[model samples]
Each structure stands twice: as C-alpha cells, then as structure tokens.
Target: MAYDNTPSFDHLPIPLTSDLVKTEHGQVVFTAVNGAGGLETKVVDLVDGAPGAFAPRTPDVRTVIDRDSFGRELRRRGLDSDGTVWASRAKGRVTAVYNDLSTDLDDAYTRRDDRLMLQFVTDPDWSTFGNVADGQYHGQEEFGDLLDDAGHLIISHQAADLVELADSIRATSSGHFESRIQRSTGSQSVGWSESVEARAGAAGDLEVPKVVVFRVARFEDFPTVDLVCQVRLRVKGGQLLLGLFPRPYEHLLREQWQTVIGELGAEIGRDIYATA
Candidate 1:
C-alpha cells in the first residue's frame, strides 16, 4: 500500500548541507528526531575522527519517493526520529537518515533504566582482592571479581596482556563491544555495577586469550549502600579466558545479586562455547 511521503517538520525549513548545525562547543553533533516528532540534535566530544563523520548528514531532498522507501533507507543508515525513520532525496541521490539520539531524542533516551535486582556482596571493599602482581593468576582473580560484581567475564593469559588481547580480537573481528555503567544509586547508597561485553558476528572459529580487570567500590549507608563494579576482558589463545574483578558494595538484595551472577555465568558459558 502507498504511504504518505511528507516530512514531519514541514514548518521548519529543510536543513541544508551548508546550514551551520549548531553543536555543543568542542562536541560532535548528532542530530535526530524526538518523540514529539521534532528535529533533535545531540553532540558528542570529538576524539580522533574515526573512519567516518561523527554526525553524517542526510541529503536534502525536495521530494521523497514513498514513505516506506524513505524509512527503509534511514534505518539502513542508522538514523531515526522519534522512533520514526527519516527519508528523502537530495542532489539526485535517494537518501534516508535519522538524527543522533543525543541531540534529537528526548531526555528519556539519555536517562538510565531501572536497576536489575540481584544478590551482591555487602562489603564495599571487595575490590581489594584484585591486587596482585601481573600474571596468569592475577588475570584469573580479575575475571572472578568481574563475574562476582557485574555480570560479565573476561579471559586472558596474563594480567599485563589485556591490551594485546584486545588488539588480537579487534583484528579480523566482525563484531562490536560496548562498555557502560550498569547500575548506580542516585546517592552513595544502593546501586548496581559497571561492565563491558564483546559481541561477535558468526564467522570463522577464532581463538583468542581473554583477560579482564574488575573494579568495585562500596559505600556505607548500611542497608542502602551503593556498589560500583567495572570489568575488562581480553582473548588468550584459541579459547577465550577471562579475568574479572568485582567491586564491593552493600544493600543489594539477594535477588539482585543472583541476577548479576546469573548474567556473568551465562556470559562465561557463551565465551567458552564461542571459542569451541
């Protein structure tokens, strides 16, 4: 069925490529749409420029072929507006795109989701266990701590070998990795952990060593104390070994702690199976 091919922001002049898209000073701009169906813009700090533009602009178009076609192209290019895709044609090229969530998406997109309830160690100082000389055992301790705190695992042959592990995995790899703070209480008391994970597309059976570092911290409000955790992983040989360290914190309910542990266990299993 044919669909309407009208731009939502008909009132605002269609942004031109030459238009100065305002961004936060020293920040990269990512423009997207909002839930209200308005133009949204976000800015990210520039590190070294990657292989592509930080905020790619869609071609300006006076007309679109059809709604579906436009939407398809926007999604293909990783653009979205208010959960809707933006499509248009400009400069003789059919184009579709979405704005960056930071700029165009609502604050809700930037807000943290709810914390996952799991049983966590009450001691906030549990991160201390990660201290050891750089070695294989150290890598293991780090992995264990990460599994304990957050719900992720890292495998590596040596503690000092994590960068190499990351390099090896990134090379000839077909997936991606994401890092973020998992959960945190608004106050110093009561929160979840931070962690990182790698995802690979199905490809050749590649074996790389794994290594991880875990960091956890605890605060004393007694029952409502906050727990913070961080983990990093690396690949070892043909198999992925993990090093994890968990931070210590209090006030995490048993259910929450169990959930975290479960996630870590599942990730470990996946890591092993993937290597196999």
Candidate 2:
C-alpha cells in the first residue's frame, strides 16, 4: 500500500541537501509542507524576512490538548501545529498525537511528570557558581546538588568504560553493578578487568567522574530512566568553570535524529526546524 510519506520537522538524520533527498529507491527532488508554510517560504522569510506572516491559530493556548491537567501535558508549541508531532525529553521518549487538524500542536518540546526537571533542564542558573579549591570539588559534586530531593535521584556509570574507570578508584573491582533499585545486572565487558583497582590506585588517590548516567524517580517512584550526562568544565584566567550537560540514551536519541525523506518528499507540518 502507498502512504503520504510525510516527514517530521526534526525527523531527518541529516537535513535535505537542497531540493534533493536520498531514499531507498534513490535520490529524488525534495519539497516540504511545513507549519511555517514550506521550505522555500521558510527560507525566503528567513533571508528576506516575513515576520508574523503565519500567526498561530491558537496563540493564547485556548485549545487545551486535554482536560486532565494532572496527567498528560495540555500545552504545546504553536509552531508544531502539524497533523501530528513528536516531542520528548532526554531524547529517550517519542510520542505523537494524530490531530484531526483542528487541535493545534502547541505543547513545549518535552513535558515531564516532574515539572521541576523540565524547568531545571530548559532554564538553569549558570551564574551562581563560585570557585572551589582543588579538594573542594569531587566526583560529580557540583552537578549532584541539582537533584537535592532525597530518595528521588541516583547516578551511576552509564557505560562499561566508565564502570571500569570507577573500579580503578576502589579497593576492589566488581565485574558488574546494580541499578538504583537494587537490581543486579550481568557482567560487563570492559578493557580493564577487576584488576583495575590495583592498576589505577597509587598512594591514596581520587579522580572525578566525567560522563555518567543519572536517573530520577518520576512522581517519586520507579527508576526506569537512564539519562546520560557529561561534566562540562574548563579552567582559565585563574578560575575554574563547571557545568553539566544532559543527553538522551545512545540508541534512542542518535537514531531518531534521522528523518525519512522519500518520493513524496516531506510534510514539515510546521516549519520552525531544529536539531533533535
């Protein structure tokens, strides 16, 4: 059976190369029907300029996505007013609502069960940091404070490599570790074995962790999340700068970034394009 071959706004792995798109059959001329009108129109407006040309139909958010405010998100981004759109946070989720064309897709990119997490990720105070002496800052210290809620947060090595590195700092090395909920896992595959404890230790040493995986209890329960994070730090001018960068799961996020551009080209649904 044939289909519309519609592509999402941030669906493509790599954006269109001009009006041409690569497909399984072969490359074909590309075109977009987007929320901002079309590819050509969006580009023209971007270059030459066309402000407020496409005022959102429900700019005031009068049209609620649903009545259950305590459950699913009722808000949306006005620019994503396509027949359907997918939005997620930490890149692990993919959800879409097949609107009947009347309901505007106006929710923010990601809606969370924990509202504070949404604000913390999207809007953070980056200026409150002060210089910490050498020993003052420890393993993921600065970033750990972001989740001060007791019993609702836990972080651990996300990968085999990081696990091995963590093992290097301990008195003994275990081939496997458990998740936050006391669930045990199988042995991990890493370049360094349980012997890493002796190899990396030398006269009492400590090392800060770089890339790690963190999980938050949704609504103060469950621990299925596996969000990746990396410590962002730089030192210069006698000052130390530090920050945290959140990322989605490896397979989940990296793969979804690729959007399908086929014979029908793509239906942008809405045109404020961006990287997933």
Candidate 3:
C-alpha cells in the first residue's frame, strides 16, 4: 500500500483567541489573527449578515500593485538607483549623461547613449538611411564583411520642446509615434513582465520631462525571432536619456559607430551630443 501523505487538520493548542463585539450603531466587528500571525480587526459585513457601519477607507499595498492604479502604471520593470535601464543583450550600459546643449553643428559629436543606439539603427556597414538611398553600399562585395562589424550608432537632435521633436520624427518616419504604456505580460516561463510607462510617459501635463519610444526595423540582421528593436528617449531634469533595449545577444556585432553618426549629424540640421 502507498503511504498516505495527506496533511492532518488536527488543531494545535497554541492558545488562539479572538474578540467579537457589537458596536453602538448596531454593527458587528471581529478582531482576529491575520495571515502574518498578527492581530487584525475586520468587519464581517455581508448582505445576509448584519451590515457594519459605512465609512471611508484608504487603500492598502496589495491593491496598489495588483490593479491598474497610478502606482502600477508608473514603476519600471527593472531600473537602477540612478534611473538607468540596463540591457545585458547589448553587453554594456545603454544610457549616458546629458551635457550642455550645443548650437554649433560643425564640431558636434556623439555621446555614449547615442553611440549605443547606432548599433540597432544603422545598416551593417554603418550607413544611414540617406546613404543607403544613395547606393553607398550597393553592389559592394565588402557588404558581408561590414555587416559583421559590430558598432554603436548614436543619432540625436535638440528641439525647442519634446512635442516638436516627436512631431518631427512622426512627420519624417514611416511609422507614427504615439503615447502608450509598456505593460509586462506572460508567465515567468516565457519572460518576466515589466512596465516602461513609469519613466516614459510619467510627465502627465509637463511635456518637457516625458518618455518617447519608437520602433526601428531598417537593419537587415534585425532578429525576427526575438523582441523588436525599441529606442527609448527619456527627457527629464533638463536632460535627455537615450538608449536601445530588449535586443537579443545574437544580433550584436562590432563595427565603426561614428560613420552613421556623422551621416545623420549632417542631415539633422542641428548640433549633436558632444563630450565635454
């Protein structure tokens, strides 16, 4: 015979105690032990039973994160103390520090955040959309060799306001950018869920410090099996936080990151991020 492993419901004499009393307003309340072994008082209000006194109530912690409340909508899935989103797929920090605004177009350069972004946006040969349109890498035997070169391509431009920049990108790019929240879904077996809205669209009325995300599928080697490439722009505290995320490791390679930056820098018609 198989040994039975069923749990026994025998009550232990641990001195369990509870208090039940009726209030002056003809309502009943009971004080008992909560799940955490702490004393708790709760009203046993029900349609069948006696109704407890109606009163206003404050929300608890569990109700905050579990529901689609403001707290749940504004917290990052994974973030550091410095408010930077780290990506292991890229094998380096994707974010960088913001410096003084540049007005000089001739001498501007790319920052670390922008450099990391180029890896996903530019072609394998580190060419921009204009270069590709101009046939810079057309019919070239070196195309395969350049595609294998992994590099960062950072492209950024300043605008008087975030709405203006977003409008410009929407006007130029094929896809229209919209304000939305990135909610985490799926089980742990698939992948842990996370929220990108906390940092991206948390500005509410203040359009200056907002987050904007866009999709980029221009590259040939963009992994179709993995998550799509998403570029996140966080504008806050009078600085811009730019980075690429959710890239699978197989797509990363080495190449010259500056080539694409210089190309876009000329077309953006504004100054680019330069090191101090």
On TM-score, the leading prediction is 2
67-175 per-residue lDDT for model 2 (tens digits) = 1321234233322333333334343222333332444357434221212111112111111111111113233333333323211233464355444443453422222
| Pairwise TM-score winner, candidates 2 and 3 | 2
Q: Residues 1-276, candidate 3, lDDT per residue (tens digit)? A: 899999875542232454556442333545454435455545554322633434312212221211123122224232222222112223211222122224456745533131112223333432332222222321112222221221122122222333353343333222222333233331011111223545542222212122222223334433212222233443333223333343442333222223333343443322334331
TM-score of each: 0.16, 0.24, 0.16
Name the TM-score of candidate 2. 0.24
Tens digits of lDDT, candidate 1, 198-218: 643233332332223333332
Cα distance off (Å), candidate 1, residue 174: 19
Worst 10 residues of 1 by lDDT: 267-276
Off by over 4 Å in 3: 1-227, 249-276
* Cα RMSD, model 2: 23.3
Error of 3 at 85 (Å): 44
Model 2 alpha-carbon drift over 4 Å, by segment:
1-144, 147-151, 157-206, 216-224, 248-276
Better of 2 and 3 by lDDT: 2
